[model samples]
Target: MKPVRIKRRFSLGLGGFTYLFVTSFIGLGAISSQTNLLFWTFGLMVGGMIVSAIYSTAMMMSLRITRVLPDHGAVDEPLLIRYELTNRKRMIPAFGLVISELDGDDEYLRGKPHGWVLHCGPRATLQAQTVGWPTRRGAVHFNRICITTTFPFGILSKSIVVTQPGRVLIYPKMYRLRRKALWDIHSRDMIGSRNSNEGGGSEEFYGLREYRSGDSMRHIDWRHSARAGKLVCRDMTRLTPPKLMLLLDVRHRGAWPYDTAERALSFVASLVVQAYMEGFDVGLAVAGTPCPTFTPHHGRIHRTRILHALGELDFKTDEPGSWSTHRARDVNWMVIHAGEIDELFGPPGAHHLSDAELDQWKLNHDGKSSRVNLVTRPRRGVLIADFSEGVS
Candidate 1:
């Protein structure tokens, strides 16, 4: 077991100040009036401050704290971090212990919050819970906690800095793809229905069945139906995965460059989940200095890998210089790029920015990209630095 780090600090609190003030007044009266009673009163007041200091310091020193973190955390989600606080002293109990992460006034810091322990019996252990929220997807960390207490006497307060190494990976916040809006994509027939072999389609043709009402007109085997003098639809085994290539383009293209980039990343996360669940063999392409790539595959493990990689993206760091042939050469790639050219990185906690707040973030459109792509697609295996870069 590692040693529990304990540092002590003392500050005059309400009760301490009142006692000191009275003592000072008594000392003044005793000196001027030659009153021995006032002298005794002054001595008692000074002694009380000394006692308060000792008691408060001991309460803080006798306690040790260890943090219990969850398996993982996610952006924009509440994660509970547990603190097990134990009092080591046999005779004295500790009270009003506040354990909190020290946050600077700078707006970019997104880390843990504070927790409190109201009471701990002598030589006993107590468990307290703290809720931490992550505002960004990536590595979240904590190094020290500010533990404070004014135990025994409300007058004297002591705070100590407890140092601990802490780190947790935060997965990207996923949004469900709006099915209603996606209907437009489906209607445009942009979602490829792979077909080639005589058995036809990705699924092998099993046989034919009488056309039911509301059946897709496209499924009708007209030749077979004519031969049988009845309306028939082809039945095919549902196999062969739908192949999709997700291209994350980081170039900012429009006015709300920061908002657009983050929103695009979120949308990408949602699409990955949606595609995988729908049986799409999904591959990922990212433009980064050391870009992380995944071949189109299937399984829950693959999904986890994707989410983990997605969480680590620092958009300002990576750039897809040119499109190069990645793993699969035949992917029907959908390239989603946030091609806004401005380099303004938003607040670190910008991921938590509300719509109203984001709207306020917009400034003069000093956008370098002559044009913006709401979203775009590229040919399978073809690389384009930007959609406007023209397909190879």
Candidate 2:
């Protein structure tokens, strides 16, 4: 835990001084005039000011602060930062404990519009909650905390500065890929030579045939060959699909801004999940100041990596020229875009398309690559939903 230094605003101190000055002047005038009523009024004003100062100081001194932050949140999601203020002194009731966070580049700096107030009993602990909505992805650090009180009398205001350091990582939204698009990649036509021979060597032995020139010596059945009076090699074959490298273009391409780039990030996340379930070695990349690369893997580790990356995605406007530079040569490439597939696939090569054009192309051809298929499809219906209803 770090130390929270206390400082009173100069304006507040000036107000306190002005209050004392006026009371003192009235008290002096009454003493000079020898008026009992004026003297009593002077005494009350002086006493009220003294009591307000002592109580205000005591309220600030007796409070202890702590913060609670969420482990993670998606872009544009509401993140709650709870401020726990414990009242150590029993006599003073804690009220108007305004807990606010200082603003950052992506967040509004004037502080959130609302705060929590608690009227604490003696030795009671009160918690004040402040929420922030992260508009972008990345780490958000809050360097300042303010705890204020106007309790007992509204005339005197007292506040303390709490220098607590905290941060939250805003992630990219996850969106789902179309089932038809996913199925197209997983179809039988996409199978290759390796798919037929992947696990065959480990299975039950099949009868041998004449040894081929390149056949491995380990596969030779000496006893069987001797009995047959001929050299023979084991026959084995198993089906396996070609590994695919799915690259998602999360960059905004045109005039139509689609509810922030976060939506595209969500769609990328959904595609990664779908690809993993279908047994594809998936890698993820995004366009930005520093693009991210997730090495291809399968199973739970891959899922976790992909989701984690998505959670931290930030939008970048700069384009990466073409998919050729980003994609791995041996692995099949699938580009997931949020706009028209044809325009998005600019100067395409071996990439499978998942936009609208790909869908239309599939109708004419039997999923075979005449020209590399570019599927163009609309953004997921669920992704286009009104997040505003919940955001504000």
Candidate 3:
């Protein structure tokens, strides 16, 4: 944690404004009538206002708040932003504390969520969380936090702004692939299996050698051992899983609909997750957006890297005129286009998904038949397909 500057400010609520108006009227009447009762009432009102200001200022002065935010968030999911509130004063307890983000992206954070704490005793620290729904994807910069309190009296609202800068990466929404038709139809050839040359697990037989003392009996070749009059062991090789590379094309010349682009990214993200789960190395390549290419690899970290790249894509700097047809060998290429598909983007025999089929990739909310059926079209340099076929 770094040192942060704090700023203090105050605001008057509606009740406080009405109370002041009434107190002024009472003081004016007292002065005009020279009545002791009216003067006493005005004096009490002034004293209460003074007390409210003093208490609120003190409460906000001796407070410290630290934000606990996650590294990244997923779109269409609840983002739990936490806060640690500490009371520095030994005697004065704080109440009605509120913590909220300052200058946050309203698009990324659907609503301005606030963390509330009813009470925090003197010299006590409490953790509170506020749930915010992330409706958009991209980077969200969090610059300041405002902790306000209107305790003891509702007249004055005192707040302290802390300059704590941070960033949260919001990933595109992903859904489960209901149908296995896509993988089932092309996985075998696209993600071809290869056997490792190194001696490894018993998935594939490699060769035979003299059995060692510590060798498992199951791996011992009994017939070979008897023929050779010595112990023989069967060596095996591990089968290497195929890899899948996603080439996302989001290129646009000028004003393009963001809904289509976002959905395309979401579909690619879902494919990355599903392929990783199905034991394939997943990689990503963005053609339109200014993003680096990710080589095919396996593991949770690699998958996160792909998703993070997708989240960081900026369509404003997209290269509309730039298109490449070079395809990496040995890995399955799945080209997902945000708009119309271009033949020069991918090589022949490559799997192509367009905006028309992006909606079907989403999980149906009404518990309807969402099973996907692959529909193929005439081969026109690049393979055009759709998941429009569904079971009722």
Candidate 4:
């Protein structure tokens, strides 16, 4: 570690002036009156200030500070960052080390103590810990770190300012769609496959079969026909359906409280876990950014990848326009918002539904809409239960 050179600034102000006046006046009076006791009193006051400054300065000099950031942290999730202060020199004991992170607009501030102080023996190292919670998703940059000390007496404060730059990238929250919604989407794809042609064209050749009357002439294998002395055709297509894409809407209209959004996000994460378990090719799409589409796979590795993304989700906007308008029409969409559903999704010309009407609307259309359904819509002011406990 490089040595941090710190300059000390101490102001005596009114207190120092008072100390000087009282001590000097006593010393002068002792000289005139030939009193040795008064002289000793003046000398003691002067010696205490000198001794305090040297002790505090030496304490600050012997200490070394370093920060440890968490490997992973979610948006609005509390994370611990440790600041280690090691006492390098054996001569001085470390005392009253105050470590604080500077406040900034981009920084997330917690009301908890920003830094800690500790006493250290010769060659002993002490660690100070602070907690950070992210308010929004993005890259969080911490540019300033301060370590200071006011040991023994409060007269002198020695300090160091560190410009260590670090950042944490936050991804969008992963949400689980309603099982009814997921089933409806999955069923739609399965039903579509029934009407489509069964074999050839797109699927890999499965080997030669005896030619049937309906078999296309192009599928006839000339080489096989010559070898077997019988007409044969290759099966070119299989009956497998296209993979279902799961699109998650993570954007909200107004500035909802941080806790409210995080709770909603955690719910989404649970949904993704459930979907991955069921062996669906689960792709993720946030409202704003282009997410790497996960072509759904079953097994433990796929589930881990989905959960990793969910753990780092942020809700701040990075793109323009409403997400509803930009949503992909082909894939199934599941939206998680903090406010009114009708305000977010109702037709442009229709009047916004009243609270009573909205409740009735959800009752009638919940789990029964074509193409799309409001799976966990709230009625009145009641919040929906988390999706992990099974959708109600």
- Report the number of the highest-TM-score candidate: 3
lDDT, candidate 4, residue 9?
A: 48
Candidate 1 ranges with C-alpha deviation above 4 Å: 1-5, 34-40, 103-112, 180-241, 252-256, 276-281, 318-326, 329-332, 340-392
Whole-structure CA lDDT of model 2: 0.59
RMSD of each: 10.1, 11.1, 3.0, 11.0
lDDT of model 4, residue 24: 81
Candidates ranked, most accurate by TM-score first: 3, 1, 2, 4
Put down candidate 2 lDDT per residue, 1-392, tens digits, no spaces. Answer: 46466565412455666877887898898989999988999999878867777888887787777777676666556777777778898687777666665444445222352476767666887666766766656677766777776666655777777777777666664443344454554442352214343334535555577887878888888988999998877876554445556566644445446543444455566667767777776776654324557656677876776677666544443545333444443455556565544334422433433343332222222333222232333452111111111100
* Candidate models: Cα lDDT each: 0.64, 0.59, 0.79, 0.55
TM-score of each: 0.65, 0.58, 0.88, 0.54
| Candidate 2 residue-wise lDDT at 244 | 59
Q: Write the per-residue lDDT of candidate 1 for residues 168-284, one digit (tens) a residue.
A: 677776654433222223333333345444443436777778988877888999998999999999877553555666666664433355766676667667778877777677777
- Off-target runs (Cα >4 Å) in candidate 3 are 179-182, 188-190, 209-217, 225-232, 252-256, 318-328, 367-370, 374-383, 386-392
TM-score of 2: 0.58
Q: Report backbone clashes per prediction.
A: 11, 19, 0, 12
Model 3 lDDT tens row, 1-392: 44288999988889878888999999999999999999999999999989988989888889988888887999988888888889999899998988888778897888787878999999999999998888899998888889988777787788899999878899999876655544654543545467779776778899999888888999999999999999999999987778777888776524458788888888899998888888887778877667778877899999998899889887777354343435445777788888777656675567777755765665567634345544455555345554454653
Worst 10-residue lDDT window for candidate 2 reads 383-392
